[model samples]
Target: MSGSDIAGLIAAGVFAVLVALLAVPIVKLGRVFDELRSSIRTLSDGATPLMDEVTSTVSTTHEQLKRVDGIAANVSDATANVSALSSLVAATIGSPLVKVASFTYGVRTAWSQREDSSRPSGRRSR
Candidate 1:
């Protein structure tokens, strides 16, 4: 063979060996990427059901809170009604009771005065 042809053949063989050696790491890197993709898909699949349950729980909690709010409003209304009723009862009974108390006090004072005027202003026995 010629000198240039021999040199060219050696270069081609060296290139082939280098390519073969580099291919192993490239193949392993591809498999690692595939495994990562599979793990991500599995994680997403598991998360779907958990997210759905969380949504349902949140909805149930919101509904219960609404019921509690309604109960609180009802209690507030009842309290207002009770307060109004108490004020009405006071208006209906308080004035007449005051007048009756004043009348009783006047009667007692007049009777006591009459007894005192009929007696001397001396020490009286209890």
Candidate 2:
């Protein structure tokens, strides 16, 4: 064979070796991508059930909050009724009690004044 032919064969062999050397890393990179895809799919599969459970939990919480609001409204109404009832009682009983107390005080004052005037003092009147 000629020297040119030998040189060409050697160059082709070198290029083939280089390609084989580089192909190992490319194949490993492809495998890594495949594993990553599988992991993402698994995560998506797991998240669907969790999302459904969360949705149910949120709906139940909303229902409970509505019940609490209703209970709070009922309590507010009861408090208002109690306040109105207390005011009515105060108006009904408090005014008569004040009038009776004032009447007793006036009668006592008049009785004391009459008794004091009737009793003579030791000092003579000027």
Leading candidate by TM-score: 2
Writing each residue's lDDT as its tens digit, candidate 2 over 1-106 gives 9999999999999999999999999999999999999999999999999999999999999999999999999999999999999999999999998999999999
User: Relative to the unseen true structure, what is the C-alpha lDDT of residue 58 in candidate 2, on a scale of 0 to 100?
Assistant: 100
Predicted model with the maximum lDDT: 2
- Every model's TM-score: 0.66, 0.69
RMSD of every prediction: 3.8, 4.4
Q: Write the per-residue lDDT of candidate 1 for residues 78-112, one digit (tens) a residue.
A: 99999999999899998999999999999999999
Question: How well does model 2 score by local distance difference test?
Answer: 0.98
**Once superposed on the true structure, which residue ranges of model 1 sit more than 4 Å away at CA?**
99-126
